[model samples]
Target: MTPIESQWIERLKQLPPKRVAEVLDFVAFLAAREERAAAPQRLSDGLARLVALALPAITEDEVEDEIQAARRERRASQQEA
Candidate 1:
């Protein structure tokens, strides 16, 4: 690993388990976001085409509802497991 990455790993190791997990989760989120951001323009162009076709039926409230529903599903699954 790079020096900076090794130092950050050491620092994370010193944290409590819960805090370490939080940091790891945030790191994972950032990595996934970066991956999405780095996707090929061709994929994004296709998404824009779809959006253009569907934007009239896809409202902001529907997006929010879908997010909330996903969160609820995750919580329920966590509780059950």
Candidate 2:
């Protein structure tokens, strides 16, 4: 194997079982955090494409009305909480 892989294996072998499990869990958490961060960009990219195609069909007034409605709903929910 490569030098880094060999070194990592040797280091892991010296650690206790609990420490090894902790390292594995931490690595998994890092991977998941990275995936979660990328998910938003992927979603936004898809939405941008849709907006580009649909922009001509929707009026600015409709967009503003929807924005106002969303803000009102958000405020109402926050007040409830």
Candidate 3:
């Protein structure tokens, strides 16, 4: 391992078992936090790919029609259930 990692190992070895476990838990928490932070950038990258495809833009009326159609379909499905 690198010098920094070796230093960290030495320090960890000096700690009590309970403190070592706490350090492990903190490292796991940091890793999970990083994954959560990356999610939004992943979504933005996907959206950028779709934009790069140069799809046709819809009018406001068309957008409203789609919303209404979706609502109607949802209502019909709920009623059938």
What are the clash counts of all predictions, listed in order?
0, 0, 0
Q: Number of the top candidate by TM-score?
A: 3
lDDT of 2 at 75: 100
lDDT for each of the candidates? 0.91, 0.96, 0.99
lDDT of 3 by residue, 29-80 (tens): 9999999999999999999999999999999999999999999999999999
Give candidate 1 regions above 4 Å deviation.
Answer: 40-81
Q: Is candidate 2 or candidate 3 better by TM-score?
A: 3
**TM-score of each candidate?**
0.44, 0.56, 0.60
Task: Give per-residue lDDT, candidate 2, residue 50.
Answer: 93
Best by lDDT: 3
Instruction: Please list the residue runs of candidate 3 whose C-alpha ends up more than 4 Å from where it truly belongs after superposition.
Output: 54-81
Cand. 2 TM to true fold: 0.56
Model 2's number of clashes is 0
